[model samples]
Every structure is written in C-alpha cells, then in structure tokens.
Target chain A: MDIIVTELTKSFAGHIVLDRFSAAFPEGEITCVMGPSGGGKTTFLHILMGLMSPDSGTIKGVPSRKSAVFQEDRLCESFSALTNVRMVLDKSFDCGEIQAHLDEIGLGKDRTKPVGEYSGGMKRRVALVRAVLADSRILFLDEPLKGLDDQTKGHVIDYLKKHFNERTVIMVTHDKEEVDAFDARLVTLG
Target chain B: MISTMFRKSRLEKAGAVFLALAIWQIGALLLDRSIILVTPVAVAQRLFTLLPESDFTHAIAFSFFRIVGGYFLALLVGSVLAVGAGHYHGLEMILWPYIHAIKSVPVASFIILCLIWLSSDSLSVFIAFLMVLPIVYTNMLQGIKSTDEKLLEMAEVFRMSRLRKLKYIHLPHLKPYLLSACSVSIGLSWKAGIAAEVIGIPDGSIGEKLYEAKVYLSSADLFAWTAVIVLISVVFEKLFLRGLKMFFDRLERS
Candidate 1:
C-alpha cells in the first residue's frame, strides 16, 4: 500500500518544521524528497518511519516493517561490516549470501575489519547495504550518500539501483543528479 | 617507534624502582631496628620462609577466594541492576537512597554492623561486595544512558530484536565503562576485603596472619604479608582485564 500524508504539521518551540504538508509515496517505487537545509525533509521522513509524531496530521498505509540508512552511518563501531549487516537478518540467512552482496558494493575486501576502521564513504556504503538487505516493506535513506566522493557516489548509485528491489524507497537528498540517476519523482519541502 | 617508546618506559620504571629500594635500604640500616622497620632483604627472607609453610598457603587461599568471590558477585549483580535501572526510571529512583547509603557509610561502621548480622568468616566477602557495587552500577548506568541515540533509532526502524540490540549497540558502548569500573573496583575490593578480615580476624585468612604479626611485633612478617597481598591483587587485575578484553575481541570478530 502507498503511504499518504494529509496536512502533516510539526513544530519545534513555535518554529514550524512541517506545516500542513501533504504528499503520497507510492508503493514499490523510489520517491526522492528534496529541500534546503533545516527544511523538515528529515523530520517528514522521521514522522513517516514513526520515529517522531506529527503534531497535527494523519498518515495512512505506512507498513509495520521498515528500515533506514540514517544521516549518520550508525554502524556498530567495533563490529565488522559483515556482522553489521547480518544483525538485522534472521538465522536462516547465510553469511555467504551476505558476503556476495558486500562484494557487489566493493566492501568484500574489508568485511573482516571493524567498521570503526572504515573511511566515511566506506561506512556509508555499508549502511546502505544494510538497509537494502533488511527485512522491510519500506526503506528510508536520509543523506545516504552524503560523504561519498563523486567517483564512489556513481558506483554506489548503480548498486542502489540494482539492489533496491520493489520496496518503497523514500530518500532525502540535496543533489539533483541523484534524483535524475534513479529517474525518481521529486517532492520539494521547505 | 611505538615499541621503542614502550621499551624506554619499561627501563625508566625499572630505574625508579631501584632508586626507591636503595633509599629504603639506607633508611633501614640507619634505624638498625628490625622491630620498627626491617630491611627489604629480611622481608624477602621472611616471605621465602613463609612460602613453604602450610598455614601460609591456607591463609592465602582463604583470603583470595573470599575477596575475589565478592568482587565477582558485585560485578554480576551490579551489571544486572544497572541494566534494570537503565530501562526503568522508577526503579532507579527506588534504588537511589540505598546506593547513596552504601557510598556514604564508612567501611569500619559497615564492618562492625555486619559482624552482628554475619559470621566473621564471610565478612570480607560482604565487605568487598559493598565496596565495588556502587562503582560498577554507576559506570554501567552511565554507559547505558550515554549510548548513541541515533544507533538506537536505526535499530528500532530495522525492527531489530532485543538480543541483537544489546549485542550490536549496548554491549559495545558499555565495554569501556565496564573495563574502567573493573580496574578501579578490583583494587578497592582487595583493600576493603583485607581490612574486614583483619578486624574480624577470621581463621586461616591473610588478615589473621597480619593481625598475628602485629601482636607478635614481627615487622618482617608484616611487610612480607603486605607484599603478598599486593602481588596477588596486581596479578588478579591483569588476568581479569586481559580475559575481558579477549572476550570483547572475540565478540567483535564473530
């Protein structure tokens, strides 16, 4: 089912973050949300993910199972990249299957090292892979590729395109090329 | 470069210890009173003699088990209580006054008070537990409270299980705090535990030996027993911390 946001309103200390904002994210497609900084793009995503509640609004059709690549990589620092991804999966999943996906995203060589030792761009890709592989009906990406260089960014965008599957993906970003790369519908918020 | 620096530090430490020993030897010679302060050589001789005695082995075993047992008990109970209080603010509030009392009360008062309720034999165990409990509880609670909120939110969104959340998030964050707590508390437990034993004068305990040395005015025996306590404390701390670190390393790898 598609998620529908109706007149969503949120404020922090009387400053409005989201003011009667309405949007619809169709199921099984990528919808990129874009706006200037501090424009409540992240707040909107947080509300839809149930991390925050809108002051006055109604949202419908949000699935119970959801996953996210937060603004921060949020990877367990001491754990390896493979362990970080494996944590969200059930026992039935094999490590070999996870390693194959990590290989596709160029993290195969460093899967054994702790994520604490990873570079910022490498950490971001690990977080992205974790989100994609999690058992979820929807995936939220908040500045998922923020720290990547242009070269790595292109490669990761390809990986996302190949792996995102049919889940509803709602990403917040400032880059227009990323939007065009996915041919994703854009929603502006400010 | 790091290995070279480490070697230099080791040499400096050895030099410092030698200088201190020289000063001690000079002071002992000038005083020329074995009753007041014995020479290090005399104390070393006394320790070697005591090492062969069955009573010495028995005393060491008696004190070692009680003090170390108390420390392990505190570690287990403190971590469990801290995790419980971390999840429930009401529970924390309820436990506040008791933790406060334990922290504020003098060790001597607790020892005397516990003597009325507990046998002298188990006094060191209880005392050690009392000394270490608050340290572990407070540090673990601080670690739990200070866990990164962003990672928790990510876990929630991913529908992660409680066991997974603990393994991936809570345990890793708590490692440093737990290590620090253990280091500080281990030494404190031994000091307090031995003090309790001395007051109670439990049979077959290191504390009983110390008290006997005091009564008999054997400074060499006194110094020897003190050195034994220090050696045991240091060895225990090193072994426990190394084991804990290995556990964390294995956890991260697996």
Candidate 2:
C-alpha cells in the first residue's frame, strides 16, 4: 500500500517545523523529499520511521517492516561490513550472494576488516547494503550518499535503482542530482 | 615462533618485576624502619618459610573460596539485577534506595551487624558480595542505558530476535563495562572480604592467620599473609578478565 501523510504538524519547544504538511508516497516508486537545511525534511523522515511522533498529523499505509540508511552510517563499528549486512538478513539469505552484492558496491576486498576502520564512503556503502539486504517492504534513505565521492555515488545509485525497483523508497536529500540519478519524483518541502 | 613469543613475554615480565623490586628496595631503605616498612627480601623470606606449613595452604584455600565465591555470586546477581532494572524503570526506582544505602554504609558497621545475625564462616562472602553488587549494578545499568539506540532501532526495524540483538549489540556494548567492573571490583572484594575474615576470625581462613599474626606480634607473618592476599587477588583478576575477553572474542569470530 502507498503511504499517505495528512495534515502532519510538528513542533519543538513552540517552534513550528512541519505545519499541516501532507504528501503521498506511492508503492514501488522512488520519492525524494528535497528542502533547505533545517526545513523539517529529517524530522518528517524521523516521524515516518517511528523514531518520533507528530504533535498532530496522520500517517497511513506505511509498511510495518521497514529498513533505512540513516544520515549517519550507524554501522556496528567493531563488526565487518559483511557481518553488518549479514546481521539484517534472514536465515534463508545466502552468504555468498550477499558477498557478491557487497563486491558489486566495491566493498568485497575489505569485507573482513571492522567497519570502524572503513572510510566514510565505505561505511556509507555498508549502511546502504545493509538496508537493501534487509527484507523490508519499504526503504528509507536519508542523505545516504552524503559522504560518497561522485564515482562511488553513481555506482551505488545504479545498484539501488536496479535492486529496489519493486520496493517503495522514500529518500530525503539536499542534492538535486541525487533525485535525478534515482529517477525519483521530487517533493519539495519548505 | 610460539616459543620465541613466550620467551619475549617472560623477559619483559621479569624486567618489570626487577624494576619494581629496585624501587621498593630504595623506598624501604629510605623509610629505614622495619616496623613501618618491610623490604621485599624480608617479605619473600617470610613467604618462603610459611610455604611449607599445611596451615598456610588451609588458610589460603579458606579465604580464596569465600572471597572468590562472593565475587562470582555478585557477578551473577548484579548482572541479573542490572538487566532487570534496565528493562523496568520501576524496578530500578525500587532498588535505588537500597543500593544507595549499601554504598553509604561503612563496611565495619555491616560486619558487626552481620556478626550478630550470621556465623563467622560465611561473613567474608556476604561482605564481598555486598561491596561488589552496587559497583557491578551501576556500571552494567549505565552500560545498558548508554547502548546505541540507533542500532536498537535498526534491530527493531529488521525484526531481529532478542537473542540476535543481545549477541550482536547488547553484549558487545556491555563488554567494556563488565571488564572495567571486574578489574575494579575484584580487588575490592578481596580487600573487603579479607577484612571481614580478620574481624570475624573464621577458622582455617587467611583472616584467622592475619589475626593470629597480629596477636603474636609476628610482623613477618603478617607481611607474608598480606603479600599472599595481594598475589591471589591480582592473579584471579587477571585470569578472570582474560577468560571473559576470550569468551567475547570467540563470540565475535563465530
């Protein structure tokens, strides 16, 4: 089912952030929410992820099983990228298949090292891999390519589009090119 | 390669011991009073002389069991209580006053009170457990509280099982706290445990030997027993912590 946001309102200490905002995210499509810094884009995503509650609003049709690549990599620092990805996979998910996907994202060679030693872009890739590997009906990407260089970002975007074609994806980003690269329908927020 | 590694480590340890002995010898000479400060040589000689006696072994065993038993018991109970309190704030609130009281009360007062209610044989274990519970509880609770909420959120989203969450996230975060608690509390348990034993003077215990030494004015025996306690405490701490680290390492690899 497609997610529907109706009259979403949120505030922090009497400061309005998202005021009666409404939008709809269709299933099996990539939707990008773009805005200026401090424009409640992240707050909206946080509310969607159930990390926070809106003071007044209604969100409907969001999948119960969700995965996310948060703004921070949030990878387990002491675990390997392989281990991090494997942690979210079901028992039926094959290890060799996951390794092949990691290799496609340029993390195959460093699969054994702890994520703590990974570069920023590498860690981001690990987080992306973990999100994609999880068995979620919907995926959230919050500035998922923030730390990646242009070359890696292009490769990851291609991988994401190809693999997540049938899953609903809601992405929050400040970059216009990212919306273009993912072929996402743009939803602008003030 | 294995033999060479062992040899190198042995040499390094010996060097450290020699350096420490030199410092102690210099300090003892500066103090210049055997009553106030005994030299390493004197303590070693006293220990060597006491080694042959069966009573020495009996005393060591007696105190070692009680103190170590108390430490292990505290570890079990404290970890359970920490998990309980972590999961339920109401339980934490109820336990707050009792934990605070234990922390504030003096060890001597507790010992004296315990003497009235309990036999001297188990006094050391009770005291050691009391002293260690608060430390383990506080550290583990803080560790549990400070666990990465983001990871927990991820686990929830992915519908990870409780066993998986514990194995991957909770246990890893708790490792440092548990190790730190063990390092700090092992010595405390021994110190407080031995003190309780001395006050209670349970038969066939190190505390009894220490009290006997004090009554007879055998300063050498006293120093020797003190050294034995230090050695046992340090060795147990090192061994226990190493085992814990190895367990975690195995978990990580598997």
Candidate 3:
C-alpha cells in the first residue's frame, strides 16, 4: 500500500502550517515534495520522517528502516567522512564502498579529513553519501544539493539516479530542475 | 596556532609564580620575625628536611590517595546519577533538594557531621566525595540537557544503537562540561579534604604535621607544609587534565 496522509494538520505559535492537507507517496517510487518558502515543505518532510508528529493527522503505510539527509548536514563534525558514513552500518561493514562513493562525489581526496573542515557543499555530498549508503527501505532528501554548484549537482543527481533506482525516495525540493532530473512524481503543498 | 597559545600560557603561569614568590620573600624580609613570617628560602629548607623523614612519605600517600580516590568515586557515581537524572525528571526532582543542601552547607559542618559517624582517618575521603559529587552531577546533567535535539532526532530516525548515540552525540556534548567540572571540583575537593584532615587531625597525615606546626610556633614548617599541599594539588590537577586533553586530542584527530 502507498504511504498516505489524510487531513494532516500542524500549527506552531497560533499559526497554521499544514491544515487538513492530504497526499500520497507511492512505495518504491521517486516522489518530489515541492513548495515555496514557508509553505511547510520542511515541516511536512519532518512529519513524514517521524522527526515530528502532526498536530492532527493519520499517516498510513510509512515504512521502517528509513534513512534521510536532513536540511542541515547533521554529519558528525569531529569525524572523517568514512567514519560518518560507517556509523550507521554494521560492525563488519567495509569502508571501500563508501570510499568509492565519496570519490564519485568529488570528496575522495578529502574523505579522511574531519567533516568540520568541509565546505557547505562538501558536507552536503557527505550527507548524501551517508543516506545512500545507509541500509534503509525509504530515503528522505531535504534539498540535499542546496549548496552545490550546477556541475556538482549534476554529478550528485547522477549518483542518486544510479543507486536509488528501486529504493523509495522522497525529495523535498524547490527547484523544478532537480525534480525533473529525478523524473519524480511531484506534490506541492502550503 | 594551538602550540603558540600553549607556550604563551606556560610562560604566563611561570611569570605569575615568580611574582608571587618575590612578594612573599619581600614580606618575610621586612617583617624580620622568623616566628611570624618565614622567608621563602627557610620554607624551602624545611621542605627538603621534611622530605627525608619516613612520616612525610606516609602522610603524603595517606591523604593523597584517599582524597584522589574520593574524587574518582564521585566521578563514577556522579556520572551514573547524572545519566539517570537526565532520563527521569522525577528522579532529578527527588535528588534536587539534597544536591542543593550539599552545595549550600559549609564544608566544615559536613566534616563535623561526618566525623560523628566516621573515624578521623576516613573523614577526608567522605568529605572529598561529598564536595565533588554535586558539582560533577550537576554539570553532567547540564551537559545531557544541552545535547543537540536535532542530532538526537537524527539518531532516533536512523535507529542508532545506544552505544553509538552515546559515543557520537552525547560524549562530545558532555566533554567540555565534564572537563570544566573536573577543573573546578578537583581544587575544591583537595581543599575540603585537607581541611577535614586538619580538623579531624588524622595520625600519619599532612594535616597532623600542620597541627604540630601551629602549636609549636614554627612558621617555616607551616609554610613548607602549606606549599606541599599546593604543589600536590597543582601537580595532580595538571596530570589529570593532561590525560583528559590527550584523550580529547586523540578523539578529535581520529
């Protein structure tokens, strides 16, 4: 069954964000959630990711084993890229696979350096790499390429398209170009 | 940049010590009364002479280990209590009154109360433990409370293990707070511990020698013993803090 939201409502400080809004995210498909600023794009993503609860709503068919690239990098700043990626993996996990992905994302040369020293775009790719590498049935991306240049963005989009072919992906993005690149089913909200 | 800062701090510390000793020497010379104010040289001579006696080593070891042991015990128990209190508000509420009382009451009063139940030989350990516990506990709880909510939420969604959550998220948040607590509390514990020993007048302890110095009108012995306490306290603080710094350095570099 598809992940479904019915009459989801949320408010903060007497201001309503999502009010009786409803949507569906089909399983095993790339879905893009799009909205202008202050349109509850982040709020919706957070609620769907179970980072928060809707004030009043019912969400059905949300899967376990979820992975996400939060709006912030949320990477451990004191650790290397490989360690950050390896953190979510099992004890017998190999670093070679994560290393190759980091190389593909232009972070191979800097993979051993602490994330604290990484630029914003570099950190974003590390976060993306972490999400892609983690074992999860559903992946959530919140503007995962927000700080990247077009060339790097293209490189990362290619990576996402290559690795996440069958995994359920929900991307929160404002850029129509990005949604188009993913060939994603779109849901625009307020 | 870090190395330069370290060297600068060391130099500053040396300069401060020199200035303090110069002032002390000048005061002793002007007073010209050996019984009232012992010169720095006289104190140093007394220290060297005191060191050869077997009782000196016994006194140093007796008080040092018991006091430092109490600190280590408090560190362990305080961290456990802080983690518990951080997880349960009701437990924290129950502990809050006692913690506040411990913090507010004078160290002397606690020593006297403890003496009624404990032998003088063991008084320093209990007093030291009591002095260190609340500080470590309170700071650690603050550390836990101040951990980043977003990171914890990330951990939750990732289904991260408890060990990983502690290592990756909680440890980093607690490091500075715990280290600062160690710094602030180590000095306090030593002072309280020694004061307890003095009041209790434990045999084979530095406090006994101090009591002897006071009753004998020996200013040089008093200054020498007092200097010994300061030196021991400072040396222990530096060594323990250095170990912590090394651990953090390895953590950050790794």
Candidate 4:
C-alpha cells in the first residue's frame, strides 16, 4: 500500500519544521527525499517510521513491519560485522546466509574483527545488508552513502537496488549522483 | 624493547618494596623493644610457623569463606538494584536514603549494632555485606546511566530482543564499572569482616586470633595474622579480577 500524507504539521519549541506537508510515497518503489538542511527530510522519515509523531496530520497505509539504516552507522561496536547483521535477523537466516551477505557487501576480508574496528564506509555497508535482509515491508535509509567513496557508493547503490525488489525503499540524500544511481523518484521539501 | 620496559617496571617495584622493608627492620632494631614494634624477621618467622597449626588454618578458612560469600552476595543484590533503579527515577529516589546511610555510617558502628541483632557466627558476613552494597550499587548505576542513547535508539528501531540488548549493549558498558566495584568492595569486605570478628570474638576465626593477640600483648602473633590477611586479600583480588576480565574478553570475542 502507498503511504499518503496530508497536511502534516510538526514544530519544535515554536519553530516549525513541517507545515501543510503532503506527499504520496509510492509502494514498492524507491523514492528519494532531497532538500537543504533543516528542510524536514529526516523529520518526515521519522514520522513515517513512528519515531516521531506529527502535531496535526493524517498518514494512511503505513506497514506494520519496518527497518532502517539511520544516519549514524549504529552498528554494535563490540560485535563482529557478521554478528551485527545477524542480531536483527532470526533463525530463518542461517550462518551461511549471514556470511554471504557480509561477504557480498565487501566485509568478507575481516568479518571476524569487531565492528568497532571497521572503517565508516565498511560499517555503513554492514548496516545496509542488515536492512535489506530484515523481513520488513518498508525500509528507511537515511544518508546511506554519505561517507563512502564513489566506487563503494556505486557498489552499495547496486546492492540496494538488487535486493530492494518489491519492497518500499525510502532514502534521504542530498547527492544527485546517488538519486540518479538508483533512478529513484524525487520528493523535494523546503 | 618491550621486554626491557616491562622488566624495568618490575625491578622498580621490587626495589621499592626492599627499601620499605629495610626501613621497617631498621626502625624495629632502633626501638629495641619487641612489644612496641615486631621486626620483619620475627613476623615472617611467625607467619611460616603458623601454617602447620590446625587452629590457624581453620581461622583462615573461616574468615575467608564468610568475607568472600558476603562480597558475592552484595554483588548480586547491588547489581539487580542498580539496573532496576536506573530504569526508574522514582525507584532511585526511594532507595537513595538507604544507600546514603550505608555509605555514611562507620564500619565499627554497624558491626556493634549488627552484633546485637545477629549471632556471633554471622556477624562478619553481615558486616562485609553492609560495607560493599552501596559501592557496587553506585558504580553499576553510574554505568547504566552512562549507556549510549544513540545505540538504544538503533536497538529500538530494530526491535532487538531483551537478551540480545543485554549481551551486546548493557554488558559491555558495565564491564569496567563492575571490575572497579569488585576491586573496591573486595578489600573493604575483608577489612570489615576481620574487624567484626575481632569485636564479636567468633571462635576459630581470624578476628578471634587478632583479639587474642591484643589481649596477651603478643606482638609477633598480631603481626603474623595481619600479614596473612594482606596476603590472602591480594591473591584473591588478582584471581577474581583476572576471571572478570576473561569473562568480558570472551563476550567481545568473535
């Protein structure tokens, strides 16, 4: 089901972030939100994911199951890269499946090393793999390719496009190259 | 180069200890009074000879178990209370008075009051427990409070299980706090346990021997028992902390 937002309003301490906002996030399609900083791109994603509530709005057709790659890597620092991915997954994902996902994401070289030792781009790839493998109907990725080099970014974008089939994937980014890479539908906010 | 640095530190420690001992021996000799301050030689001789004595062995065992038992008991209760309190401000406020009292009260006063309420046999255990509870609770509570809010947000978004949150998030945060708590509380537990025993004069306990030493004015006996207490405390602290470190290392290991 598509997510429909109508007249969504939110403010923090009398400063408005979103006012009379409306958008339709097409179901099973990749949509990218782009705007200047403080334009409520993240705020909108947070509202859709139930991390925040709109002061006055009606949102329709959001799925119950959800997953996300937050702005920060947010990987379990002390756990290995494989364990970081597997923690959100259940028994259906076997050990081989987890290893395969991390290996594909370019973390194969040192899956045994803890995520705390991983570089920023490496940690982001692990977070991406985790979101893709999760059983959520909707996947929210906030600035998923910020720290990565162009080569790594291209690889991660390809990985997301491949696994995100038939799933509602919403990404927030400022980079036009990232949006073009996914051929994603654009939603601009101010 | 690393080995040389390590050996240099070890040599410095030995040299410091030797100088202290030499000063103590010189002081003992200059005093020319055995009752005033027993010589290091006399204390060492007394310590080795007491090993074969059945009563001395029993005293060591008796105090050892009671003190260690109380330390473990405090660890269990304090950790549970701190975790609970960290989750709720009202619960922490409710518990504040009790923890404050435990911290402010003198060990001697607690021992004397507890002796009136409890039997001589259990006095040392209760004293040890009382001395350690607030410390472990304070350190663990600080640890829980200091947990990263961002990681928790990530966990909540992923809907991670409680067991996984504990194993991955909470335990790592608590490792250093728990280690410091054990280090601080273990020494206090032994000291308080012996003090209680000396006051209660429990049979076949270290405190009883110390009290007997005082009553008879046997400086050699007093010095010998004191050395034993120090030795046991150090050995147990090293072993327990090493085990704790190993436990955390395994948790983080892939």
Candidate 5:
C-alpha cells in the first residue's frame, strides 16, 4: 500500500512547521522530499516514521515494518560495523551475510572496529547499510549520505539502488545530485 | 613484549610498597610507643601467630559474607528501582524523599538505630545495603535519564522490540555508569559494613576481634586485623569488578 498524508499539520512551541501538508509516497518507488532548512522536511519524515505526532491531519498507508537511516548516524557506537548491521537483521540472516553486505559497502577492513572509532563518513555508510539490510516494507532515509565523499557516495547510492529496488523508500535531502542519482520521485516543500 | 611490560609494572609496584614500608618503620621507631602506633613487623608477626586460630578464620569469613552480601543485594535492588523510576515519573517522584533521607542520614546513627530493631548479626548487612543503595540508584538513574533520545527515536522508527532496545541500546549506554558505581560502591560497602560490625560487635566477626584488642590493649592484634580487613576488601573489590566486566563482555559478544 502507498503511504498517504492528508492535511497533516505540525507546530513546535507556537511556530508552524508543517501546515496542511499532504503527499503520497508511492510503494516500491524511491521518493525524495526536498526543501530549505526548517521547511518541515525532517518533521514530515518524523511524522511518517511515528517519531512525532501531527498537530492536526492524518497520515495513512505507512507500513508497520519500517526502517530508517536517521538524520544522525544512530549506529550503535560501541558495537562494530558488522555487529551494528547484524543487530537489525532477522535470525535468518546470518553473520556471514551481514559481513558480506558491509564488505560490499567498502567497510570490509573496518568491520571489526567499533563504529565510535570510525570517521563520520564510515559511520554514515554503516547506518545506510543497516537501513538497507534490515527487513522492512518501507525504508526512510534522512540525509543518508551527508558525511560521505563523492566517490563513496556514488558507491553507497549504487548499493542502495541495487538492494532497495523493490522496497518503498522515502529520502529527505537538500542535494539535487542525490535525488538525481537515486532516480527518485520528487516532492518539494517550501 | 606484553610479559615484559607486566614485569616492569609489577617491579614498580613492589618498589613503591617497599618505600612506603620503610617510611612507616622509621615513623614507628621515632614514635617509640606501641600504644599509639605499631610497627609493620610487629603486625606481621601478630598476623602469623593468629593465622592458625579458628576464631581468626571465622571472623574473616563472617564479615566478608555479610558485607559482600549487602553489596550484591544493593546492586540488584538499586538497578531494578532505577529502571522503574526511569520508566515512570510518578515513581521517581515518590522515591525522591526516600533516597534523600537515606543519603543525608549519618552512617553511625543508622547503625545504632538498626541495632535496636535488627539482630546484631544482621546489622552489618543492613547498614552496608543502606549505604550502597542510594549511590547505585542515583548513578543508574542518571545513566538512564541521560540516554540518547535520538537513538530511542530511531528504535521507535525501526519498530524494535523492547528486549532488543534494552540489550542493544540501553544496557550499552548504561555500562559506564554501572561500572563506575560498582567501582566506588565496593569499597564503600566494606568500610560501612565493617564500621557497623565494629559498633555492634557481632559474635565471630572481625569487629569482635578489634573490640577484644581494644579491651585487652593488644595493639598487635588490632593492627593485624586492620590489615586483614584492608587486604580482603581490596581482593574482593578486584574480583567483583573483574566479574562484572567479564559478564558485560560476554553480553556484548553474544
């Protein structure tokens, strides 16, 4: 089912962030939400992810099983990259499979080191890998490639495209190049 | 390389200890009064003579069990209460006054009051538990309170189960706080527990030996028992903390 948002409005401390905002995120398609900072892009993603409630409006069709690469890395800092990926996988996905996925993302050498010790780009990669590898009907990514270098970003985008081909994916970013690279349906918020 | 490093550290520690002993021996000789201060040699001789006595062994075992028991109980109860308080604001509010009361009250006063209500044998356990509970509770609560809100938000987004969130997120976040609390509380439990024993003078306890030493004016026995308490306390603290770290390591690996 497609995720439908109708008249969704939200505010923080009397400042309106989202006002009667509505959009439909298509199923099995990559959708990108773009807007200036504080234009309610992150708020919209948060509302859909059930992290925040709208002041007045309705969101429908969001799947129950969801995964996300948050605005922050949100990787378990004390755990290794492999362990962080393995944490979200179902029992059927063994450690070897998780290691393979991390290796594909260019994290093969740093798989054993805790993510806390990793560079920002490396941690971002781990977070992206975790979101894509988890079993989820809907995947949400907020600035998923923020700290990555251009070369690493291209590789991550390719990996995401290959793996998330069939899942409903919603991404929030300010970069037009990222949106173009993912070939995503575009939604702009003022 | 590792063994060499270990040997170097061991030698350094031994040299420091020897220097301390030399200072103590010099001080004792200058003081020239066994009543005020006993020499380390005298204390060691006293300890050797007392080593074969059944009472000596019994005293060591008795105090060790009560103090360590109180510490373990406090650890379990404090963590449970802190978790409850973390989950419920109302519960935290209710616990505020009790925790404050325990923290502010004097240890000696508590020992005396507890002796009236509890058997002398159990007084050390109660006192030790009382001293340790608030410390562990406060630290663990602070840890729970300071957990990353963003990570919790991520957990919600992923629809992770409660157990997974705890094992993967909460426990790992709380680790430093728990380890720190254990480090501080282990020594405190022994000190406060033994202080209570000394006051209550429980039968077949280190406190009783100390009391006998005082009554009979045997400074050697007093120094010997004091050394024994210090040694046992250090050994137990090292062992308990090691065990805690090992348990966490296994949890992380699994």
Candidate 6:
C-alpha cells in the first residue's frame, strides 16, 4: 500500500510551512525529500511518522509500525548503543541477532559502550542501525548521515541500502549524493 | 590537581569548624552560665548521657520513622503526580493552584491547622509531607518538561514501549532533578517535621525532649538534641542520595 499525502497544510504561529502539499510515497521504495532550511522537510516527515499532525490534510496508508532516525542522533547518551536499540525492539529479539545488525555497521565491538562516548559518525551509524533493525513498515531518515565523513558515510550507506531493501524508506536530506547513492525518487519542498 | 584541591577544601572546612568551636567554648566560659549558652563540651557530654537513656532513644526512633516515612511518601506521590501532569496539560492546570498554595503558605500555619485536624502523633508526618510535596513536584515537573523533545519524538516513531521509554529516556533525564530535589527537600522535611513535633508536643518524640529541655532551662540538653537532629538529617541525606546515585548508575549500565 502506498502512503498518500493529500493537500497537507501546516503552519507554526503565523508562518506557513507546508501549504496544501500533495505527494505519494509508494510502498517498498525510498523517497528522498529535499528542501532548503525551514522548508518543512522535517515537518513533512514528522507528520508522516505521526509525531506531528498536519493543520489541514488527509494522510492515508501510513502503517502502524514505523521507525525513524531523527536529524539529531537522538540516542540515549547514558545507555549503551545496544541498550538504546533494545529499548525499541521486542524482548523476543535475540541479543545475537541485534549484535549482528550492529556488526553490519561496524559497531559490534563498542555496542556495549555508552553512546555518549561514541564519535559523531559512530553515533549516526548506531541511530541508522537502530532504525533499520526495528520491525517497521516505514523507516524515516532525517539526514541520517549528515555529520559523517565521506568514508564512513559510504560504508553506512551501503549497510543501510542492504537492510532497508524492500521496505518503505522516506528520507529527508539536503545531499544530492545521498539521493543518487540510494537511487531514490526525489520530492522537493519550498 | 582536582584531588589536591578537594583535600585542601576538606582541611579548610575542618579548621573552620575547629575555630568556631573554640570561639563557642570561650564565649561559654566568659558567660559562666550553662543555662544560656553551654560549651560544645557540655553539649557533647549531654549527648553521651542522652544516648544511653531509653527516653532519648525512643524519641529518636519515633521522630526518625515518622519523618522519614513522610518524606518517602511525598517523594512517591510527587513523582507520580509530576509524571501525570507532564503527560496531561489539563492535569497540570488543575494541580497548579494547590501546588502554589503549598509553596506559599507558612509551615507553622499548616502545622497548626493540621494539628486541629490530625492527631498530635501524626502531625510531624503530615507536616513533612506538606513541606516536601511542592518541592519534589516542581523539580520533577521541570525535569519532565526539559526532557529532550527530539529523543521523545524518536521514541514515539519507534513505537517504544512505555516502560522502556521511561527506563531509557525519562529516568536518565530525571536523575539530576530528582537528586537535586531530594537533597533540598530532605532537610526541609526534617526541619518542618521536627518543628511540628515541637509544637504538637507529641509524646516520646525528640520535640518533646526539646520542650522539656526548654522548660528546665537546660541549654546543654537543648543543644545536644539540636546536634543530634543535624547529625541524623545529614546522615540520612547522604545515605539516600548515595543510594539514588547507585540506582541511576545501575540503570544506565543495565
């Protein structure tokens, strides 16, 4: 099923963000949303993820199970990267399986260390790993690779593409390289 | 360098206390009166005698249990209420007036009014609870309010379970606020609780011992009981805060 946004309108105070914006996010495909700063790119994603409601709009086909990597890493600083991931996963998830997912992102060795101690790139990978590994119908990535160096970014992008396969991934970013890397369909907002 | 500075501070504190004690001894000697201002030695001696007395021990036990019990109860209730209000703005609005009233109203007034309503024996508990509630509630609410919205949004999108959200996000955020509130309110609870006892003259309470000391004009007994109260309050605060820190440490690790 496709997630459909119809004439989505949102305003903060008196500033218009999204003005009757319409778009289609097809099932099992990556849709990369791009825009200038304060262009409602993040707002649109937030609405799609049900974290925020559009002022006037109808959204359809958004699944109940959703996951996201916010613009900020948003990892629990005091907790281990593994523990932060485990908070979202069900108890039925095996520790070995979770470790394997972390290992895919080259974070297996320090999964037990507090994410507070993790470097910027390492933290981004942890957030990405957490989002991809969770059981979700749609994965929202808000600049998930924003702060990473080129080498780490390429590595994580590969791992992300592998795991995000055949899943509805809606990513918001300003990077055209990331869009081309994922071969994602682009939706520009103003 | 930090450890050396810490050691230096500790030594300075000890020297200051010693100097203050010496000044107090000289003042007492000049006055030549135990009834007015007794020497620290006299107070210490009185403490040793009181420690062996059944009445003194019983009073300590009585006041200790009620006051500490009241503080814990307030902590529990305040935290629950703060969490509730954090989730529901309407609930916070409803609780606003009462919280403000508790904060503004004089403790002595509450003690008197409560004495009319409650029995003398339970006066300290209620007073302590009343004193500590607003402090805990306000600080905890501030903590809950200041929790990172970005993290909360991530939690929401991931459909994180409530228990997990609390354990991973909320508890960590609340740690500093809870520690700060506990440190501050514990002493207030003790002071307010003992004051209530003093006014209510609850039998077998430290307050009653103080009252007796006052009536007999025994400054030594009065000073001794006062010192005992300070010691108990400080010790309890240290132990409770340490336990709270340990709990947070274990939570972060687990």
Instruction: For candidate 4, report its TM-score.
Output: 0.96
Q: Give the alpha carbon lDDT tens digit for every residue of A1-190 in model 2.
A: 9899999999999999998999999999999999989989989998998888999989999998899999888787888888888888887889998899899999999998889999999999999989998988999999999988888888998899878949999999998988988888999887
Pairs with steric clashes in candidate 4: none
lDDT of each: 0.94, 0.91, 0.91, 0.91, 0.90, 0.93
lDDT by residue (B125-223, candidate 6, tens digit) is: 999999999999999999999999988888888878788888999999999999999999999999999999999999999999888888999999999
Interface RMSD of 6: 0.8
lDDT of 2 by residue, B151-229 (tens): 8987877788998899889998999999999899999999999999999999999999999988987767888999899
- Between prediction 5 and prediction 6, the one with superior DockQ is 6
Q: Which is the leading candidate under DockQ?
A: 1
Candidate 2 interface RMS = 1.3
Ranking by DockQ: 1, 6, 5, 4, 3, 2
- What are the per-residue Cα lDDT tens digits for candidate 4 across B1-254? 99999999999999999999999999999998999898999999998899899998899999999999998999999999999999999999999999999999999999889988999999988999999999999999999999988778777777888998898889998999999999998989999999999999999999999999999998999999999999999999999999999999998873
Candidate 1: segments with Cα more than 4 A from true spot: none
In the predicted model 2, the residue pairs found to clash are none
Model 5, DockQ value? 0.68
List of clashing residue pairs for candidate 5: none
Under CAPRI classification, how is model 6 graded?
Answer: high
Tens-digit per-residue lDDT, A33-150, candidate 4: 9999999988998898887899999999889788899988888788898888888888567979878878887889789899898888988888998898887999999999979998
Best-performing candidate as measured by lDDT:
1
- Candidate 1's docking class is high
Q: List the residue pairs that clash in candidate 6.
A: none
Ranking by TM-score: 1, 5, 4, 3, 6, 2
Give chain B TM-scores in order.
0.98, 0.89, 0.95, 0.97, 0.94, 0.98
Error of 3 at B31 (Å): 1.6
TM-score of chain A of 2: 0.97
